[model samples]
Target: MNTTNLIATIALLACATGVFSHEKSPHHAPKAAPMKEQKEWGIAGDVKDVRRTIAIRMTDDMRFTPSAITVHEGETVRLRAQNKGKVLHEIVIGTQAELAQHAEMMKKFPAMEHDEPYMAHVRAGGQGDVVWHFNRPGSFDFACLIPGHYQAGMTGTITVLPRKP
Candidate 1:
């Protein structure tokens, strides 16, 4: 081959080698496995190791469906609340005094760190869950502390019964 042709051939070979070398390099790591999606919170109840799931839908109308619930004392309950309305809502479980304190704190702190053990706030188009263990046999009230939601009838009752022998 002539000098010019030899030079051209060497350049082409060098380009091919570079491309193949990149493909063979160990620097390119294999892609990681996709992460598992986080589970969304919802209402669930346990009975003898069997769990029953319930859906509580909230609306701008300011009401909770099946506004009454009955459970045995010392039972574990999982409540999933979904806001299907244009306004924010919450499901708070406490005594009359506790609820009052929560409302007052919410007013002052707004996004204050909630110390209540059984309360969940669900914003519009959002959902949340609350797991509660009823240890006492009494009438408990669940209400939304969203400004006027409670006054607008966004409240319900939970009756805990005595444990059966």
Candidate 2:
């Protein structure tokens, strides 16, 4: 074969190999997200470190059962959220400002993709939980940022009290 033809054939085989490798390789699995504390929201806590567990229910009515909760500063909590509704829902914890910003973004991009440690995307009738350490003394918020969910009033509060000396 001529020099130019040889180079073209080699490039073709390289492209073919790149495309076929995925079909043969066991290493094509999706990458796992690294475990990291979301300190902007709060430190990530372990299940064993949970000082308390609170049950929260989400409904099609766009509300959370026991929509308000309190915890002492530096306390670790396991928030168990159950979706009782007939639609997909998610629980995202953040500051009220953050929630509002995210909610607005969701409204604009209803199918936006997200993966966050402080967020739990649950299917209908499914349940999930998050272990978070509220090391800061302040009020935070949790909401369902599924487009119209937040506007329909799917939000709640977390009050972190001052630590007792």
Candidate 3:
């Protein structure tokens, strides 16, 4: 081959070697093991009481199971929220705007007391209970206002239907 062709061939071989050398480097070594997936946990469901007590369970999937609840006006509801997860969760009962405002306030105050209506913030592997009386018939949302928990579908609907005459 000519001198120029020989040099060009040498340059191409050098480039190919450089590219293959990267695969043998330790920095490009395969990961020791695949990362384990993180588990997301959230509220379980909404409970209604025709008698007195209502039970709800929070799962470890960042969602409310029931997603909807129905109750009669003028009835007292005893809501039991159990966090069966590895993260903190809360149960807040209010309108959409009220819950939004409460979420904002929660951002300002992490340890703020939630005494309005009925609410509870439970830690991981903990449980909370709320006794609320629904005097009026309307639609309410039960949610968890822990940062991004609410937006993660950790909410339920409370439908307080009017009592029949």
lDDT of 3 by residue, 61-87 (tens): 877656788878777777778888898
lDDT tens digits, residue span 1-165, model 2: 667546655875686687588778877877676587656558777778887899999999999997999999888898998999999998989988888877866775576555666778888999988778888888889999998899999999989898999
Off by more than 4 A, model 3 = 1-50, 115-117
For every candidate, C-alpha RMSD to the true structure in Å: 21.4, 11.1, 22.0
Tens-place lDDT per residue, model 1, 104-131, is 5456445533333366788899988776
TM-score of each: 0.63, 0.78, 0.64
TM-score of 1: 0.63
TM-score of candidate 3 against the unseen true structure? 0.64
Which residue pairs in candidate 1 have backbone atoms (N, alpha carbon, C) closer than 3 angstroms, thus clashing?
43-80
Q: Give the C-alpha lDDT of model 1.
A: 0.68
Model 1 misplacement above 4 A: 1-50
Cα-based lDDT at residue 93, candidate 2:
93
Please give the CA lDDT of all the candidate structures: 0.68, 0.84, 0.70
Query: Best to worst by TM-score, what's the order?
Result: 2, 3, 1
Number of the predicted model whose TM-score against the real structure is largest: 2
Residue 40, model 2: lDDT of 56
